[model samples]
Target chain A: MKSLKIFLLAGILVASCTNDPVEEQDSWPVDFDALVALNCRAIELRKARFATADSLRLDMDSIKASMNQSDFEKYQNDFETRKNALLSESNALADTIRLRMKGVMSDLGPDRKRVFNDSLQATLKREGCE
Target chain B: MKRILTLAIAALIISGCAKDDEPTVQETPTKSAAAKTYDADFMIDYFSLQCDIVRNTNGFLPTIAARGYGYLGVTAYESVVHGIPNGQSLAGQIQGMSAGSLPLPSADLKYDWALVSNKAMADMMRYMFGVNLNPDDAILIDNMEANTKAQLSAGVDADVIARSEQFGADLADAIYQVSKTDGGDESYLNPWQTPWEVPEADYCWIPTDLQLQPLSPDWMNNRSFIANIAEDTQIGAHIPYSSDPQSEFYAAAMEVYNQVNNNTPEQVTITEYWADDPFQTCTPTGHTFNILKQLLAESGATLEKTAVAFGMMGVAENDAFISCWKSKYDYMLIRPVSYIQEHIDPDFTTVIGTPPFPAFISGHSAEIGAGIKVMIDLFADAQGNYTFTDISQQQYGFTPRNFDNFYDLANECALSRFYGGIHFTMDNDKGLELGIAVGDAVVNELTWPKNIQ
Candidate 1:
């Protein structure tokens, strides 16, 4: 058994000398769709925000009054729920991207620092949500 | 080619000069049908014939035009859908189709006066009459309608003309029923807010079943809501001047008002007389158009043909209105006012503040947008152009510019809402989409007679 194992090792060693190792293709399943949905929700939120902002000019007091009322507060809560749903969805996408990129970090090594910063900045901006 | 180029450049230069620089003729052609007849103006909100009836110094013509104008201006868009078979209005479809999307299908919601222009008037006439006016009928209806001398000499008093027109309208109402005979459920042409006993479905913008729905006590207040007997209702009346024989224009208005009220379900009370604040500006007092269906008699469109055409347009417009209203109501989000009233918006300072409504879609934009589509179709086969010139006064027909036909009128009329401040850029965009879509569908779907074909 020892001799047989040594023979296998010797073959691997000889092959290693002559052959260049093939790069491992890391294929991780990505939920890109979650990201798309998050972005769509974000865009819709942004439009609603702008529309609300536009409403302030006519009767600021009334607008505030209406928004402050319970029904509007409920609506705001619903909106926030949707916003958080998008954030979670985006986070799931970021996590998937992270896992895939980690497996192929050697190939993406240079791309890693640049793309990671860009992605971190983007996610942070989204999370911060001003 | 060189001469044409030089002329084009010269014409451009000349046109660049203010319209005021043009020569003014002092002749007031109010009495002369040859001079005062409906010139080829497409911009006129009321038919030139109706205008002529009002312009008559006989004191009754203006009254006739005023009555007709009110009917035309306030109700004609709705009626056009009801007047015709399967004549759906663009308003309803747009309201429903574009609902919930502001950036995509948003439109303005308010009264769109452009719905009353010449194309609309002519379209109403064609749909009511069935037969397109041969040049002679167009000319005759055009000539005899306005001038005081012509109307007076035509043997009928204001009473007779009005009565005949009323009868024509009644007939139109009955004939419009034909649209529903084969249309399945969609054939019932509802021109205005029909208070659904159980609300509505499909393209219903306002869900009668919703708990948060606004109460439309005033039917006209909401584009899709019907003012019921519980609300201040406006039931129509038939004062056939021909039958009454002694009916005057002012008297007709009063009588019509009375008749409408009397017919009201015994559940509500009404004002004893119409009151005047006296302080209201003269701007609110201008005349409106009422299509004298009897005027089609002079135009040689047979009574049946006129009724059919009128009924078709009326039915279509109403259908459009209902369609639009439901679409909007179903997507009850907000109006310009709602968006305008919001306090948190930063861009509010950049704009003339919006109304108390959602920001995305415009109600007026959808209604006028779609209404104009059905209107244009009714006249697609007819002749005559549209012209409107707000001269020293806001007189539409005062301009001499020529129009090829009704399509040109619809194009320019659609833009007028922008100036009126009721619709936004995006609202107009979507409204136009729905209007054209619905109008096309109704026009194509409705069965026109083989003779007209």
Candidate 2:
């Protein structure tokens, strides 16, 4: 996979602010990080939380008609843990994206690089891109 | 002789310099006036610039403009109110007005909540997911007319940007005005009302001849798209750079839902009692769903087709509901209630009187408008060439405006909220624009491999 990427990179201009309108049209096809890593992390976090919610639903309905304070607290803690985990990972992913955009802009000396980096970072963070 | 010549030349030069020294302040005196701050005296005198700006009867231009402008509004608002998860709004005044509850504008029609809520939602959506409807994947262009930002983003003139902003704000104003008087106590622009028995020709504003035509074609078979939208929109409305899980979507959705639903009956004097609820009346047609079914039947369509249309409409509506709410919460501006309740009018309790949410824009009106737009578009697109002029009319307390097309349908949808006495003028205006924008996104983006589109 690494070798294939290198070969691909040789033919492609990764950060080129191309003047050719046709070539620039959906040219990259994918922002690789968004497609692979960020997407994967986000889904993993969601699936994990959804699974937790299903478990809690079952417990609240059937198992835990009555629960001790400690048990309730433990449940709350678990929920928070998952939430924080996702939030942290998402933030990290967003930072990574910001870094990448900054890297691209710096390479191209593009104006409004910071604006793009910041907005894109916030957008990713808001989406919880883990 | 030389001294005399030098002195004469010096005098000429000084005179020329004096003539040119006039201040460089006015850049087209009228243009400068248009750019003046309307909120200078804490009273905004928003001048309406209703030029015949090119808008498609249906397509990407207005949709992109709506989304892009909303992003701009929310971002600006958020910048103003930093740190807090949410900000303030203006729905309170509209709420009072809609209820016929507030003494007319003269007694002191404080802040307009309608405008604030609409702006808030627009801003939040952009903050969450700077949407990418133009398939070529960039912010700078409308989807149908993608300029491929690589070539165009740099070359975009400043005037185009200004025009787009004006277009959005203008659309908001028009929507707001439509809702204000449509069936409510104040509606003036829209003389015709909705969910009615027959059309009042004088009630509609759009020319008589224009009302003779039917809705678009593509919406007929695919009308069922509304019911399955959020799930389907996961395909079409998904931003190109968006990551998975969409935590922001969920978070914002939850917040918006909570904000709207959390309102206790105690807050607003209205919505506590149904206008003609089934329980209160012996009529089976009192149910909203039943009435809708009846309306569908009147169209002379089969039950299956009607059901399909409603379902698609349902999806469109739900997606819009989710979209608007999410957008609002993400941007989270204080409601007009905050401004009026604190600063302008102490007696004023907005329809959702408690004023829990900050307002900048109207999420409620926007979602309602979008849902109606989607349904109307779907219905019209399917049943092409049959104009709806003078068919259905209602005289709700807020408006009496007659509607004709999907655009008209969207206007009424937002108006109903205002008539119901929940949103302010701005809220209704912005919401309708947002709704149509969302509907447009769904129409353009959601596809099923040519077998569908």
lDDT of 1 at B421: 33
Superposed model 2: Cα runs more than 4 Å off? A1-130, B1-292, B350-360, B381-402, B415-424, B447-453
Candidate 1 regions exceeding 4 Å error are A1-130, B1-313, B336-361, B378-393, B396-426, B448-453
The residue-level lDDT of candidate 1 at A52 comes to 45
Clash total of candidate 1: 95
For candidate 1 chain B, the 10 contiguous residues with the lowest summed lDDT are B272-281
Isolated chain A TM-score, each model: 0.35, 0.40
The TM-scores, one per candidate, come to: 0.30, 0.27
Retained true contacts (fraction), each candidate: 0.04, 0.00
Model-by-model DockQ, in order: 0.02, 0.01
**What does the interface RMSD come to for each candidate?**
27.7, 22.7
Provide the lDDT at B160 for model 2.
42
